[model samples]
Target: MDFQHLSYFIEVVRHASFSKAAQILHITQPTLSKIIKNLEDELEVILFNRTTRYIQLTDDGEIFLKFAHLTLSMADDLQVSLNDGKLLKKGKLSLGLPPVIGVSFFPHIIAKFRDLYPGIHLHLIEEGGKIVEQLLRDAKIDLGVVVLPVDERHFDFIPLVERQLSLIVNSNHTLAKQEIVHLSELRNESFILFKEGFSLNDRVREACIREGFEPVISYESSQWDLISEMVGVGLGIALLPETVLGRIHTESVKVIPKTVPQISWDLAVIWSKHHYLSHPARGWIQFIREWVWLQRSMI
Candidate 1:
């Protein structure tokens, strides 16, 4: 029998009344009864036992119910698989990126992805790395760019950038002339850092603690450019990813190429291990992997 007839039968059995099932299914009671009759005729058996008070399933009806449920389940699975393939042609993706990371990268990658998958709409959420991690956990975004050293147990990540942190000091600062500055030498200096939600905040703090002293904080900001601007004014020194140095146009600050205990500024694209990744999200990860590979080959 057809799926609709089987569904009506299940609803009748659920309510134990043809009138109640018809009301729930938004059809007439007579129509539901006729459909059930046709289903039983097709199976060549009495499917239901009817009485004035209530209705009950016959022996054949109980056996047919099991097969009906299995058939509907398989049909649903087939529909879902077909829909997933259609999604590859047109779908949406939500991606979270820290402000610093977005500025240093992703613009070109995003443009290229749009070129390749013109039908897929992209929604970008800009937040600090810590906030991005929270968004992923909450399932607010499909994928995220976060700083490395994340909880590997909770996330599945692909390493995007592996680099070291560079020190930036004002031109007039004593350490400006030095090509390489030891992390310990900056212990006495006022440090400008990224705000609380940024992963760099913790990374810098942990690195400083490893070097045997805590940094004396002078200011904190969410924007890397603002932090570097404060450094340019001789307010305090800041450590940032070396890749971002090219974008810091403030000639007042000089970047030190080397640090004694080199703190890493690695980045990774992450998604929650527990969350269900949509087709577009999975496609994005694959696209990025290929893009990164192409970039490395060009380099």
Candidate 2:
């Protein structure tokens, strides 16, 4: 059936009045009525029961409404996918990323994507997980690389990598030589943590609370590098993901695995469900999934 006819039919069903539907559609009542009549004839089904004062869907109309909604939704998705392809060929894709993940993977991903689709532009925004989530919710970025267990009701998450949390301490610290340590071991030690609004900070605090004590916070910094640097120089120990450790290596600091309520964080490709996925966004999603699979195979 013609999509326009289905559109009119859906509108009529929604309003339950031809004049109301036409007014909303910015079409005249007679034209709208004609379109619905033509749609019914084509389908060979009575779609509505019209009285002098009211319009109601017939039994067939009710059934058709469900299929109509589905068909329209799919059609819209198909159109969006097609338009996205054109965008990838000529437009740009904006990616919002957390600092640690962006530092490690953004260059490689951008290089690979440019090599494959030279025409598409790649824009990057470096922010913390909370900022990334806000940008996604606001439709500011097409996609985001963020830490997961985020409120999944608003955004869809695709896992990229899962890395264990590490306990970082100055080389001269008492726990520095240990290969593994429990959260309780650091109860009295002053800590350098990520500032408020960061997911990692919340994870670290929650893990500490579960161990029967809150962390002794000497300092908090949103800059990951600064936090690591502080821990390396005997300022205080900090909890960070394995990926961050890989980025900021310091001879003055050591990394040990955490065991009690073993904490790990997921790196995810996140996007809002309310926002439509652009072509480059979809392509990047596929590429990231394949890359993750390949990395797993190698491991």
Best by TM-score: 1
lDDT of each: 0.90, 0.84
- Report the Cα lDDT for candidate 1: 0.90
How do the residues 54-125 of candidate 2 rate in per-residue lDDT, one tens digit apiece? 888999999999999999999998888677686676567898876766666567867988888887788888
What lDDT tens digits, residue by residue, belong to model 1 across residues 1-299? 68878788889989999899999999999999999998888889998888546788889989998988888899998887668646676778999998888888779889989988887889999999999999999999999998898898889998887889999999899998999888899989999999999999999999899999999999999998999999999899999988789998877999997898899888889999999998889899999899789878998
Q: What's the true lDDT of residue 195 in model 1?
A: 92
Cα lDDT for residue 113, model 1? 90
Residue 24 in model 1: shift from native, Å? Answer: 33
RMSD of each: 9.4, 12.8
Candidate 2 wrongly placed segments (more than 4 Å): 1-84
TM-score of each: 0.74, 0.68
Which pairs of residues clash in candidate 1, taking residues 3 or more apart in a chain or in different chains?
none
